[model samples]
Target chain A: MDSANERTAEEVAWIHRIGQGDKAALQLLYQRYASRIFRFVIRMIKDEAKAEELVNDVMMEIWKSAASFEGRSSPSTWILGIARFRTLNAVRGKKLDTVELSQAPEAVDEGEDASTGKSQEQLRALMRQSIARLSDEHREVVELTFFHDCSYKEIAEILQCPENTVKTRMYHAKAKLKPWLKNMGLAEAELGGVT
Target chain B: MTEQRMDELLAWYANGTLDEAERQEVEAWLENNPDAQLQLAEYEFMQQSVAELGDDEPVFNTEAGLDNLMTRIETEEAANEAVGQQSTSTMLERLQNWLDETLNWNRTPAFARVAMVSQFGLVLALGVVLLLPSETNEGYEVLSGTTPAVIAAGPTATIGFNVDTRLVELQQLLREQQVVIVGGPSAIGTYQIELPKDDLVEARLAALKAHPAVIYLQRNEP
Candidate 1:
């Protein structure tokens, strides 16, 4: 089997061990996904402390319910689905405001001067800012596809939406992001020129 | 595939997540359209940027988080064990009650009952001789002199009376409520009282429950 499949198999084994009340297996699973889940949650809720707490909460849920996992989806997809659910709930329950692209603060990378031409790092900084500012739905689509490396189907599973909805969200997310790239002097021709 | 369709899939294509057919279609479209290439590049750049968004953020304290999670799991396991023990105790109590009601020794033939008790007493005496210390030679004592006879009357209810209730007061209450003591004040002090079938059983039970002398009550339907 390929590395991805092998990793998935290993994770499934850990989940089985966890179901049998193996604390070491739980620790291994935690080591694998805790940081990723924390990053996803922090991005969604913009609260590091609460994000840390929610990461443990997700792991705790896995420990409690691992025996019920039916292997319907990849373990990563299941983990992200749980993380997304908890993050969204925390957002709604706490009434936390999601940062919109239009209202996002201007990119302020060090040594970034408009007079000088933009470097790759400068452009990357601007891209990060723009992505951070996308609407929650759009940003989630972008992150799941790009950062999380989830296919449209897996994204749909994580978001609990139809595959077509995932596609549409990605389309709108790119549309929203293109303008920001253009504003950073990355027009259609220059997009290819970025080395 | 149409350009609009290709546009919708560009993000997945950039992330290398499209299936073979979808990937081929997107690549074929990209070869024919240079604009699509730029869009794909933009998507690739976006993917790289989003993936690296965490590079600047401080690392999360995973060890501490794991410790906390383990603590919670331990607490949860302890609570579940306590609940399991409690449930077992309750189930055993229910099973004992079921056995008491279903296998009423009082209904057995007197000869068989006496034989079973004699066998039981012999086993107990042997156990006491084998298990007890020599210095601790206190013999078994009978708690009751005789077993109460079984009541074979019509519908009855079992009740427990308050320990401090006077005999006069209990007799007066029974007379007023029109219930007769059929049996018991068994080991647990519960008495079997026969209620009039003409009166509503629930109303009678509710009235009994409200009386100060009565501490517990239950229907004893056969």
Candidate 2:
């Protein structure tokens, strides 16, 4: 099997053991992916406490429903999908949609760069501000693709959207980020192609 | 593919998500299009900036969280097991309690309850007995008075018959039936009958009424 299939088989074995009520197996599984899931959830939820709560919820869900794991996707993708839904629920619980939050005039994060020679850290901070400006959906696509190194297909599965939709959203997200980067004094030559 | 599709493909190509065939296709499209190259360059910049956005680990106590979660799971499973382990008698008691609660039976006085049960049982038993087949018909008797019936004898017999065979047949028929006089002739000169109180009594009285010795016969009670 390829690496992806191999990883899925390994996680499936762990899940089978988890189905047999193996707490140690659950712990092992948690140790393997907890940090990554926390990162993913915290990015989406934007609240540390809620994201942490969601992490626990997602893991507990995995433990209870491990027997139902059909291995249709990789274990990481499956867990990330659960995290996605749980985070969305938490967001809804707070009476907020990412779209609304992004649209809010007060929620804008325009990292106005100083008009002088700036350090790489300042440039990076400005870039982070640019990301903070993108809509929730576009931001998620960017996060899953660039940070998590997920392919268009994996991102589509995680976000429950079509592959073309993922690409389109990325296209729009880049459109939003391009001006922000340009304002940071990064020329087109140094920045390379649109991500 | 349209220029918009080329841009989308370029986006995927920069992210390394496009297959080699699509990557070559985008590369071929980009060869003659510097503007697309510039757009692709901006896309790459954005991709790099987003990738470098640092993710900070949230401050959460994993041990405590897991402990709470495991405790909850254990409690739920234990409760389920306890329900499963309940004895059949306990379930029966619960059912009985529910019935009593629903019907308000527990509020009834003890003696009245017993009396009600006894009456129900008696009615049920009587109904069954009535339904059963017996020598007598069901609902066969309804007395109008408490008085006994009267049978009067004639002065003497006057019949033309083969005397020997007639007497023999009469004796055999009378022997098959059982009859008993309950009282003697009083001032009215009538005998009272108490036995064979059934439908057959009417037939027996008819035979006696046809006899020349029977002056008069009447069934005053049944």
Candidate 3:
């Protein structure tokens, strides 16, 4: 078997052991997925402490539900899906103020300067800000696609949304990102010599 | 395709996930649309920049979090044991209950129910693949003398192999582990192959490293 299949099988095996009450298997799982989950949750909640707590909550949910993992999606997809729901719930439960995505400025005058001539780090900072300004749904889709390298189908599974919804979110996300990238002049800089 | 459909295809195009035919179509579309091509480049640049955002940067300490999880799992396990369940049937019973509650198959929209059932079928098919006997009872053959023998139990790594290695050859080498190509050589020359994850990950890595055809091995992170 190739590595991806092997990893999936290993995850299934871990879930099986977890079903049998194997703490070691659960630990292996924690080692495998915690960081990724942390990054994802941190993006969603934007609170280090809360994200940390939610990560544990997610692992706990997995610990309790590992037995029911049907291998329909990859273990990572399942875990992240669980984390997404938990993070959204935590956000709602806390009544946190999410940015009104519609209010995001179309032009970033200051970011444009950084994009055209600034270092890659500066451009990345701009990108991060652009991501932060996205609506929750758009941002999640963008993060899954760009940072996690998930396919549309995987993102759908993670978000429990339809693939077309994923595509639409991504399209709107890019639309939101476009003006920011344009303002930064980052896109122009990157593609300056392309055509 | 409409403008909106083309826009969606552009995202896939920049990601290098588009198949050859789709890619060709996108490329053809781009020929007359330099603006779209620029957008594609911008998307590619954006993706790469985003990927670099969290490069080995420590997010937060999870050791304590893991400890808490272990504690809860132990607590739950002990409580269940105190109930004195001997047969594995109880585990299966609990799993069934959880599945019913989680999927809520009865109330889920028709589309979700279909996805759930399809996923179940795929898993069952995989289980059958794993159970089938191969040249080695453990399910994989060591392609070279230097390759260490490993007993397949659970867990798998998705290794990217050289482009020249044929799929049929991989099937012969992989044996009981299903050799599914999940991803590709893209701009870089690598074929992402999925195999059953098992204890013999190290052995498998060593075997692949020793094999002349394996290009790169990466463990898929969820």
What TM-score does structure 1 among the candidates reach?
A: 0.64
DockQ of each: 0.47, 0.22, 0.24
- State the lDDT of candidate 2 residue by residue for B1-222, as single tens digits: 888888876766777767778888898888857678777776665577666635433455667767777787789899988887777568888977985987566898889779877998999999999987654222111132223333423121111223244655645544544544444343444554443545676567667667654555565432
lDDT of each: 0.80, 0.68, 0.72
Which lDDT value does model 2 have at A69?
85
Q: What is the TM-score of chain A in candidate 2?
A: 0.81
Binned by DockQ into CAPRI classes (incorrect, acceptable, medium, high), candidate 1 is acceptable
Between candidates 1 and 3, the one scoring higher on lDDT is: 1
Ranking by TM-score: 1, 2, 3
Order the numbered candidates by lDDT, best leading.
1, 3, 2
Predicted candidate 2 versus true structure: per-residue lDDT over A51-163, tens digit per residue: 77778889989998998888887777788899888888878788644434454333223455432577766566556666766778888887777666677888889889898
lDDT minimum window of 10 residues, candidate 2 chain A:
A101-110
TM-score between predicted and true chain B, model 2: 0.34
Kindly report which residue stretches of model 2 are placed more than 4 angstroms away from their true locations once superposed: A1-5, A93-115, A191-195, B27-48, B51-65, B86-89, B92-222
- Chain A of candidate 1 compared with the true chain A, TM-score: 0.87
Q: What C-alpha lDDT, on a 0 to 100 scale, does residue A54 get in candidate 3?
A: 82
For model 1, report DockQ.
0.47
Report the candidate with higher lDDT, 1 versus 2.
1
- Kindly list the per-residue Cα lDDT of model 1 for residues A21-53, writing each as its tens digit: 899999999999998898788777656788899
Best by lDDT: 1
